[model samples]
Target: MLRSTIGGLLIAFLAFGTAAAQTYRPAFDPGALKGPRAGAPNMVMVLGTPHLSSFPESFDPDRLGGLLERLEAWGPQAIAIESLSGPQCDFMRRYPERYRDTVEDYCWDPAPARAATGLEVPAATAEAKRLLASWPEEPTPSQRRRLAAVFLAGGEQASALVQWLRLPETERQVGNGLDDVLVARLETLEGRRNENTLIAAPLAARLGHERVYAMDDHTADAAVSDKEAYGKAIMAAWDNPAVAKRKALDDALADEIGTDEGVLVLYRAYNRPVLAQLAFEGDFGAALEEPSPQRFGRRYLGYWETRNLRMAANIREMLGFNPGMRALVIVGASHKGYLEAYLDQMHDVHLVDTDTVLH
Candidate 1:
């Protein structure tokens, strides 16, 4: 009887240990799983958080709550946001001093009554006003200085800082010609407030205004034409040896994976001479050639690759030395698809199911 009881206790101890081991797995690991290197940082918590379009009025709060809970439970040391590189972020970092009131004051706030009794504006306008009213007061000087260092550093370094600031209210009233057009579009969009992207704002806001890092390269301007030209150049460089080498490396890893599970490669769809010259002729090498947009889609795609690689490198550099760090990247969905493919082939990343997260 004594021997039997001891054996039972041992079995229970082993079972409990196994369960605890499973529960304690790190969210990200940069090591291997089967061979000698198995269990390094081989695991990465690559979640695809939604952008403005991912929210809808009918969005499942439970689903979103679950997602956020899981992420927090995963205890990711860092979160990456999509808008960290924008002017909006810059303004937030230097509010009331370098700039005026928060973006919410300019964009989300409703225009004050013009004559004490014009018909009350649309509900969308009213909502925008409410949002502006909610913005926190401007940052302190020390905060501004800290944010300046972040913005100056550029890349994920800046992102880490921007993520900590609160999101400005959506712009509603327009003060200028550009503002007028932008406001009109925003109002039109707001009427259909049932979209998931808009609904997700609260979730993003809840993720602590500062815990999320922006995951984009700050150098790229939104100028459409310039981007188009740059895209062309990248496409042209596809034939260069260095480009061949990068592609080969990506392909070799894909081959080894046996399953196209974790890599994303972005290729340019347009080629511009100036951009081509800059990417290929500059430090990046001849592989960065400009391709013809006329032949592709008349839109710049190569810029995506250049931007993504720079961002990825920054992220690696920022957190590579930190022990037990997990990262989630949010970006344009089109880019997400390509990036996922390329990242799958990387050394220590496991692509989480983006589609699952989206729903």
Candidate 2:
């Protein structure tokens, strides 16, 4: 009799647990559901692609080719790129001829000539160098440190050191020292540089001459410098009386972006938020859990969660700008889960499976 009672109680507990889980909707936003009409533009397709590689062995053109084919077939009126930004847009609008000339200079400059080295570099590297060189002044120490971080994250230790040295004295301090931890991190990133480039190129080729937009608002590093200041700025913008009146229109604009053009945004999977929640709930404390299930119970989960939330928010806002705009967000694989879930909650957005694309 006691065993029967225990079993019944266990079943009840399980049912209650399931109910609680169901109640937890990460993307739930009452305002998004009915706040305003999304006058969607035309068609929006969001896609996530694999990372780029230096050599053919590291490349995955077939996967990228498939994505391009889909975009071409869809025939978007204006395809926005992940590489263009608002400031650049302003520059282009204000100085079309000068902007064209600058872009041409970068594209036309021989890799060896620009870097003043005989190193056989990829087009992305060449382009990045040109862009970096053309800036008004040398990068600040913080900027150099950020570049080092990028190199470290990308597994390019040598490049990180090279970039670090190129910066002024103040910036080099940000790297601190050539410690083992920093070295190992850079080595890992160096290994992945080839892969990063290969993934970005074909997509750029396909978008050809259209309005490829760079959505990065220069906020990541800015936030790093002054988090409170950045928050205040965003808040101030939001609190402006002019902005408050246009909230509905802004929401509508987001929707329009989704329906207008097929857009893709990429992010590293190791940066997701659910993985953080899982880690906090699991054995590991605040420290980043290792990438082993036996030790960390699927260590990459938190990273994936962080990446997804960020990417989804970006996609959602961009889509809100125009309905019917198809956006393709290319991010690390682990982030796929959260992005898929978040986008699914939207009224008509479709989440394309990366596994399907990979297969």
Candidate 3:
């Protein structure tokens, strides 16, 4: 008699829940109210790219010439890259247990710069900003060198490179706070294969821009209790046919990355509308459906969403500072779709169509 009563209650509860789910609707949608009622809209283009470091050693950097030309023609006044800000890195450093690995892997130590300039991250960042605020129409090589040193002290390597690149080859000497160690580091960055060094910094220098923004965030990294179990669960979820298909596509594209035309083709493929859905199926979507006792997949999905949302917010905050500017954001291909969707919801942001620019 008790079992039958419990069963009856469960059925009624399920029916009521189904009705509630079907009838609910949001009161309004913020995305529909597009804007900048007075002037030109803030234009942003997100270029999804594979990590240049992943390319084979034989890959020629000059092949990027055509790609750089196309991007320069777009006339972006500001550029942002997928690198953690100096401030963020400094903040994360306060909690060693939580962010030790992140710092070791992603953050550049400002120790040497601090020793040279006698300024920590915050102070160096402040100095760099203050110098740029009243920057002269024609800054001497000494001024550029000073700014580069401050940027290094602030842990902004790419921006330092921009300053380094803008100077004449002969002017890249050690002085004005740029000690021998810092100068040597700048020289090393010249041949680095990373996208920020190869694409963003050089492009900014060519455009006469002072610095490129670093807007990546990793505060959402999670610490799971059962390490082995969590890893096994996520790995098991990824063992799907969709993942295999995606790998096959990536391999084919990578094979053709040796030439300018091939590089452009790879960019085109990564920026396509369909790649987002494919990415979801192969990674996040598959993780969401994993049947784990601890629901490890859900945890992974939560972390992914949190990280992307923070990154999108950082981009939005950058745009909020100056309206009606053309901004170029270069990020890992997997992040492109998520960022575009988030930024599209903003009232004043106008997403530039990648196809028009890439072609």
Q: How does residue 15 of candidate 2 score in lDDT?
A: 99
Point to the candidate with the largest TM-score.
Answer: 3
Off by over 4 Å in 3: 1-7, 18-25
State the lDDT of candidate 1 residue by residue for 1-359, as single tens digits: 99999999999999999999979967674433322254445334344322323343443334334445444444445555444333334434444443333333322222322112131233323432343355346644344333322322221222222322232443224332213433343344334332122222333335543334445553432344455555566456555655555446434533322221211111111111222333333324443223454433222345556666766665555445553455665454334544554565456555565333333
Best candidate, lDDT: 3
Q: Please estimate how well model 2 matches the true structure, expressed as its whole-model Cα lDDT.
A: 0.40
Q: Model 1, residue 215: what's the lDDT?
A: 54
Q: How many Å off is the CA of 230 in candidate 2?
A: 30
TM-score (C-alpha) between model 1 and the true structure: 0.37
Model 2 TM-score (2 dp): 0.35
Worst 10 residues of 1 by lDDT: 263-272
Per-residue lDDT over 223-334 for candidate 2, one digit per residue giving the tens place of the 0 to 100 score: 1244455344434333433444334433443332231121122221122344333324332232233332232222233433454555556667666666666555544333
- Cα RMSD of all models vs. native, in order, equals 21.2, 20.0, 1.8
Model 2 regions lying over 4 Å from their true place? 1-46, 54-67, 76-205, 208-303, 348-359
